[model samples]
Target: MASFHLEEDEIEKGEETMGSEPEVDEDPSSSSATWGPPHQHGRRRVNNYSGGAVGLNINEAPHVNKDSTPFCVFMLYFARIIRLLVEETNRYYHQYLDELQDGPSPRPDMTDSEMFLFLGIIIQMGHDIRDRLKDYWSTAEQFAMPFYSNTMKRDRFLHILRFLHFADNNTETDRNADSYDRLWKIQTIFNTLNDAYEKYYNPSKHLAIDEIIVKFKGRVVFRQYIPKKHKRFGIKIFKICDATGYTYDMKVYLGKDRTRADQDVTATHATVRGLCRCIEGVGHKLYMDYFFSSPDLFEELMTKDITCCGTVRPNRKGLPDDFRRRQFRLKKGDIRVRVRWNFTALVWKDKRDVYILTNMHCPPAEGSFCDEHGNAIKPAIVADYNKHMGYVNKADRMANSYSISRRTWKWTNKLFFHFLDMTILNSFILLSSCDAKLSHREFHLALVRNMLEHAARGPPRPQRSRGRPPAVSSAISRLEEASRHHWPTSSTSRLRCRVLFV
Candidate 1:
């Protein structure tokens, strides 16, 4: 259909000549038009369309809902997706026995489970449930209801506690230690969510791997230097996002150091290794910045059949002059590469020339691949340019304007700090996948602030000291008594009998 509308110039400029004279080549019985333009060089022919419905469409054009309203299609579609996520999460929680060890008979009201559901729903809806709850319950009198009665919403607080890994046994009132498990859990949840989103994505050959810095608080133990809160930090994430930012696969990494600042070679390598593991066996070309320039890592990845594409760092070590030249000159296992180039230079490597190295062998000429040393070039080719995709650092002229102190973050609750960043990223990915109209970076910037604002809407209720433990019900007492004197009966049956006897 497209070709019929716009053929190549070869077809458009063909040299089909016209005769010098006009003559009727039809029988007298044939219908014909005797029309001619004045002073034409030669006779021309025009075919008249005799098919039906040549002038058909009249009303449908303007009537088709071109209304300037936000389409509810995305809202409905995203709602359905979120609903599925909630149901699946609920099933997973029960299936894995997240509450199994908490007690023998599960509480009719599962506080932890409710919190999980609440958080899941919040994330899925692209809003913070806590903030929404607070907005809905603004007064002390309004909190008298059973759901809102708890001074701190202990269950909800517990959920956040688990999410942040805040331990209950810290000696100092000032001690605010966040747990490792909470951070890991958030990663796990998003990974699972990404997998689920992938099953519905169209299979394209290209995948993009890039990094985006989300502002963070606290000194990351792994990071060498602390970056300003809004300053760039490497967030090594591998995603299979379409041109419109619909992500098929999303893998987020915190970088070599929490700060992802420079001077951490080992951390960078580890980040590459983790990102590479996600890319392995996906049968797509992956892109990276010069920071990913490492020959050993590339070769290791190539051995596993994953091709890489990115600018290679110049100098500092062993790279052959030409990849093609080296292909024949060097042995299979002897190859090693190390990147050493100033990124600020027009061409960072080999006397101010951009360098690219790929197991792909061929890449777009505009993005020619070279070895550490100036080498023979090959035309770049990927199975599909769309599938082997990427977007590098945003042009500096248009970066975000807001700034926050990088140092002040260290004193905050670490898990919430991390959660806040992850939540922004997760929301961006969610909005991108659901709304086919936005780009990855566009979605990241557009909705992230709103999501963070929602997160920062603050508490729905006043903070309080830890409260008294709930009284043990008669059923629990009977269960405890049964534990002391177990009969030759099921624990449930023994407890029931003890309750009646008591």
Candidate 2:
């Protein structure tokens, strides 16, 4: 319940007074201030406590170009992943058709090449599938041809949609399962992409964990209503991303069962633990929002050699009573610091109280920032958290900007397209990290172009040359001779007589 206040005199003196206090716990097991050995030699250490900067600097980060071909970076990383999805989809589609009893094949079967084109069309044309298909069939433009072949009809594409499934039919199992348990439909695909994501890139320090909502109004039991979100109703996904918006890991939120408890684990703690499981013992520092930050979670991360930083809600358990109490007397730049056995909680009063919790940072000797008025101060931990916490949000914004997802009655289809968008977004992040100088739109365009070009059957045909019309040699000679020989009496009659004679 105790808290230590930082006075203006102490701030002006630039003294490190918080470390001297007995309340600041020095337990090696719980304190994140203590340094540990590097996770691996030559591994780039993310912001460490010596006031090291967090996240990547755009100018100084390493440049790695895996392939020189346009969109080769995307293909190199995601080609196999896409192929797997297509194969699974086709397998399930055929199985579904064969199982049908009443109708004459519920839908037509699709080939891998056709499926690739379908996805490419989605990337190239961000519209309703039917409208895009209509345009593809009706337009005279060359760009439209690569997206949908001249031979392909709109009905065929619709058939593909009708039969698309990521998993096999198991009505018995599905019917017996809970309504929220339908995530098994696409679980394999999700696992495949996740594995590829982690294996392809090693995340830098300063990772962020946050939720992403894929907007949907479909009939589903697990549909969430987050009024604050732009799309209030959708399926929720928890994501852990790095500084450049590269998703290192993700977990779909099904319901309360998404978190499994061993003893006294909270949902927030369990979610963080699940997302960060792969990166444990690697000395990575994770940043999250108040929803996931807690004293016990920070302690848990510290044990695994990971550092944690985030804003904490005041009402959360384990927050000191003094820290929680409303402060009307505190000025704009006033600060408070409370160091527990496991984590440090900082309260800086700017326009309002901004509370920060971290196992990675300690109280600053001199608060490192000034507001526009030059009178208000900001904490370094606050600044650092603000800088890195937006990575997941950045990923979300980029994905949603030119989303290829369409309005669908089926939540599963919406979820599938959402996955596709995330896949492309992740590829963009990876490519940009490797020094590919392209925006998200450019990356997607290049991917579409590459896929279409590669799948093309043959080179485009050449246009035939148009030569001059055959010369009227005989007629010209006759006309010249007639003109030389004849000076007619009546001009019109003479011309007619000369023509007849010629």
Best by TM-score: 2
lDDT of 2 at 362: 55
lDDT of 2 by residue, 1-502 (tens): 1122322111222111110112333563443443222221121223332222322222332333534444565554466656666666678766764564333423333555666667777786653344544666665654345435553457676766766777665532644544535587777778888887776676776788888778999888878786655677989899998877778799887766632546477766877898988778657878877777777788777777788887777766666666666442566677666655445677777766777777676555423345566556656777777778888878887887778888788887898888888888877776666566787777888887777666565443233235423236644565567795553456799789889999
RMSD of each: 20.5, 18.9
Q: How displaced is residue 31 in candidate 2, in Å?
A: 15
Model 1: ten consecutive residues of lowest lDDT: 1-10
Off by over 4 Å in 2: 1-64, 68-72, 75-88, 91-108, 127-151, 171-181, 325-329, 365-375, 457-502
Give the candidate number with the greatest lDDT: 2
Measured against the true structure, the TM-scores of the candidates, in listed sequence, are 0.39, 0.72
Give the distance in Å from residue 35's predicted Cα in candidate 1 to where it truly belongs: 70
Error of 1 at 478 (Å): 29
